[model samples]
Each structure stands twice: as structure tokens, then as C-alpha cells.
Target: MDMTLLSRLSDFEWRIEAHGKMRVPAILYASEELIRDMDNKVYEQIVNVATLPGIQKAAYAMPDAHWGYGFPIGGVAAFDPQEGGVVSAGGVGFDISCGVRTLLTALKVADVTTVQQPLADALYRHIPAGVGSTGRLNLDDQQLDEMLLNGAQWALKLGYGREADLDRTEERGCMAGARPEAVSEFAKKRQHREMGTLGSGNHYLEVQHVVQIYDEASARAFGLAPDDIVVSIHCGSRGLGHQIGTDFLREMVLQAPQYGIELPDRELACAPIESPLGETYLGAMRAAINCALANRQIITHLVRQAFAEVIPEADLSVLYDVSHNTCKVEEHMVDGHLKRVFIHRKGATRAFGPGHPAIPEALRAIGQPVLIGGTMGTASYILVGTDESERRSFSSSCHGAGRQMSRHQATKRWRGRQLIDELAGRGIIIRSPSSRGVAEEAPGAYKDVTSVVEAAEKAGLSRRVARLEPLICIKG
Candidate 1:
């Protein structure tokens, strides 16, 4: 984290020139304070990433970068398959397709306040949460495979959600190329009862209200106004995704030598993109992505039901849904030529700029909606991708206020019951199965979200749209 260790390119850009076995430079986008606060392991991991086979451009880290398994948590990199590119399981974290989705509600802040406690209790009762939580649906082997292959579309067929919701979702709620058979039987079993449940560790469903609008034009495009109520769901594929990552990471490590991959670190184990192992992993990974999308869609349906019980007239509509962790095939301009590449985004959100065909047609002029989640007590922000971001960092941005402390450290520093009481005093209701879970996610345990978002905007990664504050949180 030493300032002198990197070459300063600008206020928000720092670079480590390619050297030794490195194929390209490693770039970090952050303010001076944020860069100094980053752990040294982030620098080492990114440098390690630069040495990987077929890596393109550079290995970049966002403002919220943190040390992770192989690549840094807020890392971004692309690879070319024709150039012997590799697909790494470690590049995608255990919580595959972990992401956030926001729902626009007809009610405003004042309406929510009238039944805040009732609504909170209803959501807590309706939405299954906590470790090993089970939802109402229990799929058999055949049904599980269908869910894995079809994602939210499967849920919609079962009367969980409407068709319109797919238009606002990434990949239209079902990721293609998902080979359910590639997923292990044990992984499918683990997800059977966890379809609509919010798994433990940093996952939550919150009722939030917009408090500030940063860009009027973008805010209008996203259908946001001051004091409007919104619900945000943050989670992933649950046990299925974790098991897939575990299964593949172990296999990748054992098979790397056979593929002629000289791993800089055992955790960076990978197989060549064209290899059978790599293709199989991608198939299963894509299935997990669908699992996450289906899970979120089901949760949205549950949220609607909860609202109907408390405020019958309230209408909840999908604002946008986006995933953070995955290796996606995308086309990018490389050396003045448009080339296809695999983009790995770990703990980073895809922020496709305006006019990109990938973005939903309705929101294309403004850009993709980048949802940035905050802690239970802090404020979350909505940002839009910028054209400059595509050139700067592959149209990627920070996912959240990166953790500055471990869960153990957070538990030791704060008591959950007391913290919940404190949050309640500030008009935020907290509901969870475990008090320890609440303590583990103490707001002070993370970096200043406002500072992170400001750095991201200044770095041209994304532009802030609106700010949201939590009114009720159902944590896991």
C-alpha cells in the first residue's frame, strides 16, 4: 500500500508497470486515502493476475479493492480464447452471480412510515432468511434441473412473477449455455429448498427510500424521485453456487498441470478456455448464474406478497437487476479492433455505458443502472454507466462499500442487539434470525460508501444517479 510502490497516473489512477513474467500492467482506481488503506495482498494478487495466460490489457482494481482468494475482490480482467486464454474458478467467487436488484414501489417514504413496523415484520415472516433457510418451494431432481436451466422464466411459469420483469433483468432472467447436467448432484440437492431463500453472510432484503438525486436526467430515466420508496434485494445462488465453485476450483487445481498452466499461485488454478474442463466449468457456472436470477425473482414475488398483506394498493415494479461476480463473454475494443473476450468481474458490477446494445432499450440512452449496496445503517446509491468507463475499466465499477474489517473483528467491536436498538433509534428497523449476524455486518466495519462512490465517479467508472436510505432491513 506504499505510495511509492506505484506510479501515479492521475488523482484516481495508479499503475504498476509490467515486469518479470507480467504480460500487462496492473492498474488501480482509487483516491490516495483509499489506496493507502488497501491491503498489500491486493497489489500482489493483481500483479499475479497480470502473469496469467492470455490476459488482455491490464488487471484492474476498483476503489473498493480487497484481498480475495486468487484475484482481488474488486478485480477486472479480460482474456482471449484464441490466444490460449484460461478460465479460472477463483476469478469468480463462491457466491456466483451475487448481485443486487431494486424494485420501484408506488408508495413513498411517508406511506412506508405509517406501517413501517408492520411491513418489516411481514417481510421478515414472508421472506425466508438466515443460514440454511428453506423457502416454500422444494424441487425434486427434475424440477431442480428445470430451474437451473430456465432461471426466472421457470419461476414465472409457476406464477411467481410476471413476464415484464425479465425485460429489466440481466440476460432476460435466464443465462444461456447453462448445462444443468454439468452441475453436481450434491450441488443441486443443496439448492433444492434454498431457491427463494436469502442465504447468510452479507445478504439482505431492504426497504429503502430515495433521499437525494445527483443527476436529474439519469434519475428521470431510472424513474426515481426524492422520497420514493424502493426495495433492494442482495444475494446469490446460495449453496449451489458455492458448491460449484468449490467443485471446480479443486478440479482446476488438479488439472492445471495437465493443461500446461504454470500457476503463480495454487489458488489461481485454471484451465485453457478451449479445454474440456474449462467448457464444463463454464456450463455449470452459467447454471449457477441462472440459479441466482431465479432466486432474486422469487424473492421479488415474496416481497410483493408481503406488501399486499400490509399495503394492498402498493405496486412493486422491477427497476433493474444486475449481477457482480461471473465470467461473461463480451466484445471489447482491443488495439483498435473489436474482439471477443471473457470478462471476469469479482465483487465488481458490470456498468455498460450508454448506447451499448447490451443495455435494455428503454434505459440505453442513459446507460445501464449500476446498483451500489450499502450497509444496514448506511446509505446506498444508484449510478449509471458512462461511455468513458468502457475505455477506462471495461465498464466496471465497485459493487459496495468494501469491508475494512473481518466479520470476527466486527463481532468483537459491536453487539448486535445494541446495534439493532441503535439503528431503530435512527428509524431503521432490523430483522434477522441471529444477533451475531447483525454484529458481523456492522456499518462501521466497512469503508465509507460515499467516499467510494465519489472516487468511482471521479475515476469515470460510473456517474451517481440517486441515493437511497434503508428504512427496514431483513438480514441473513
Candidate 2:
């Protein structure tokens, strides 16, 4: 992160040139100020990622880059299977398919403000949250398998959500290639009661109002307007995802030597793309992605129930849903030839530009919606993918205001009770199961989201569409 050590390519691009076993250079997109604030570990992890087999173009760190397990949290890299590429467990992260989904409500800020506290209470009562929270749905083994395979489509079939919601979701709400048989029984048991639950640790459900529109066209496409109310759900695959990551990461470490893959760090353990273990991990990982999609769908239903109790005529419709942590098989141009590659985005969102077939047809002309979540009580933003992004970083962008400190460090710095009271004074309502959980996610513990989004736009990764200011937050 130090200026003296980096090779500056431009105001928004910095490079760590290939050296030693590195197959490609490490490129980071961020402003000088953000770069200086970043942990030195991010530089080391990205450089380590570059050393992996069959890495393409470069190992990239987005504007919100931070130190993570193996690759930096905001890292992006693509690997070609035909070129001996490998799949890394650390790259996809533990909370598989952890993402943000915003829903458009017919109500406005004025309608919510009048009944804010009671509405917040209703939401907290209806939506299960916090560590080890269990939802109303208790799945049997058969139902669990079905949900794992069907995802949001399963939820819709079960009357949790409408048919139209699937069209606005990534991969149409169910990632292909999910192998329920590959998922361990232990992982399945862990998630049997987690559906519709919001697990703890930075995960939340917030009610927000559209405060600004930067791109008129995209804003209209996303159904945004000044004072319009929206509910955003930020969560993931919960226990199943964690168990899958834990199981495979341990297995990959043991299998790495057999595959002749040298890991710079044990945490970066991986298997060759063609290997059986790699295929198995991918199967399990995709299932977890489906689990998350289904989980969010169920929660969306619960959110509707809560809103109906507070405001009888409220209509909550899906805007878009996207995942951040994933390793997706996609095609990209390399050396003027199209190449099929596995793109691993850790704490990074897929920013498919306009006309990308993966995006929903209704919004194809504008591009994929890239939701950037801010810390508690801060403003979040909705940005659109751009064609320039496809060329620059394999169509990836930052996920959020990357953590500035660890949860332990944050808890030591601020008391939850005081933080809650402070936000309450600012007209923000905070509802949570534990005051301690609140302390660990204090707003000061993250980088400035506005600055991060600005750097992302300046680097041409995504174009801003609108800004959202939080009215109430229900923390897990």
C-alpha cells in the first residue's frame, strides 16, 4: 500500500509487477488516499494470487480491497480450464453467494416516518435474525435436497414469492450445475432451519429512501425516484455455505500436493479444474449459491408479511438480486479469441455490462445492477455495470465499503448501546438481538463508501445510478 513500493499506472491504477513464481501482475484500482488506508496484507495476498497456476491477465483488487483469507477480499481473477486453471476454496469465501437484494415499495419516506418505530418492531418480530436464529420453515431431508437444487424457484413453487421475482434474480434465482448429492449431510442439517433467517455479523435488513439519482436512464430502469422507499436484504447461505467452505478447504489442502499445485499459503489451497475434488467442490459450492437465493426469497416473503401488517396496501417488488462471492464460469476475450474461464470474485460483485445475456432482459440495455452496501446508518448506492468494466477487471466491482478493522477491534472501540442511541438520535432506528453484535459493526469500522464508489466510477468499473439513505436497520 505504500507509494514507494507500487508502480503507478494512473490515478486509479496501481500495479505490483510479476515477480518470482507469479504468472501475472497484481493490479489494484483505487484512489491514492484509499490505497494508503488499505492493509498491507491486501498487496501480499493479491501478489500471492498472481502466483497461482493458469491465472489470466492479472489478479485485480477493487477500490474496496482489504485483507482476507487468501486472495484479498475485493480481489478478482479469471482462470482458464484449458490452460491448467485451478479452483480455490478461499476465493469463493465461506458465506457462499452472500449478496444484496433491494425491493421497491409503493410507499415513500413520509409514509414510513409516521410509523417508523412500530414498523421496525413488526419487521424484527416477523423476520428471524441473529446467530443461530431459526425460521418458520423446518425442512425435512427431501425438502432440503429440493431447496438446494431448486433455489428461489423452489421458494416460488412453495408460495414464498411470485413468478416475476425470478426474472430479476441472478441466474434466474437458481445457479445451474448444483449437485445436491455432493452436499454433505452435515451441511444440510445445519441449514435445515436457517431458511428465511438473517444470520449475524454485518448481515442486515434495512429500509431506505432514494436520495439522489445520478443516471436518469438507469434509475428509471431500476424503478427509483426521490423519496421512494425500498427494503434491502443483505445476507447469504448461512451455515451450509460455511460448512461447505470448511470441509472443502481442509480437503483441498490435503489434495493440493497430489495435484502438484504449490500453495504460497495453505489458506490458498486449490485443486486443478479437471480434478475430481475440484468438480465436487464446484458442485457443492453451486448448491450453496442456490441455498442463498432461496433463503433470500423466503425472507422477502416474510418482509412482505411484515410490511402488510404495518401498511395494508404496501406493494414490495423485486428490483434485482446479485451475489458477490462466487466463482462463475464465463466467457471473455483474450488475445482476440474467446476463452471460457472460471472467474473468482471474493468480496466482489459481477458487473456485467450492457447487452450481457446473463443480465435480465428488461434491463439489458442499462447493464447489471451493482448494489454497494454501506455500514450501518450510512448511505448505500446502486450502480450499473459498464462495458469498460468488462475490459478492465473481468466485469467485477467492489461489493461494499470494505472493513477498516476487525470485529473485535470495532467492538473494543465502540459500545453497542451508545452507538444505537447515537443513530436513534439521527432518526435511524436500530433493532437487533444483541447489543454486542451492534458494536462489532459500528459505521466507523468501514471505509467511506462514497469515496469507494467514486473510485469505482472514476476507474470506469461501474456507473452510479442512485443513492439510498437508510431509515431503519434490523441487524442480525
lDDT per residue for candidate 2 within 228-267, as digits (tens), equals: 9999999999999999999999999999999999999999
| Model 2, CA-based lDDT | 0.94
lDDT of each model, Cα atoms only? 0.95, 0.94
The clash tally of candidate 1 reads: 0
Predicted structure with the largest lDDT when compared to the true one: 1
- The whole-model C-alpha lDDT of candidate 1 against the native structure comes to 0.95
Q: Once model 1 is optimally superposed onto the true structure by TM-score, how far is the C-alpha of residue 444 displaced, in angstroms?
A: 0.4
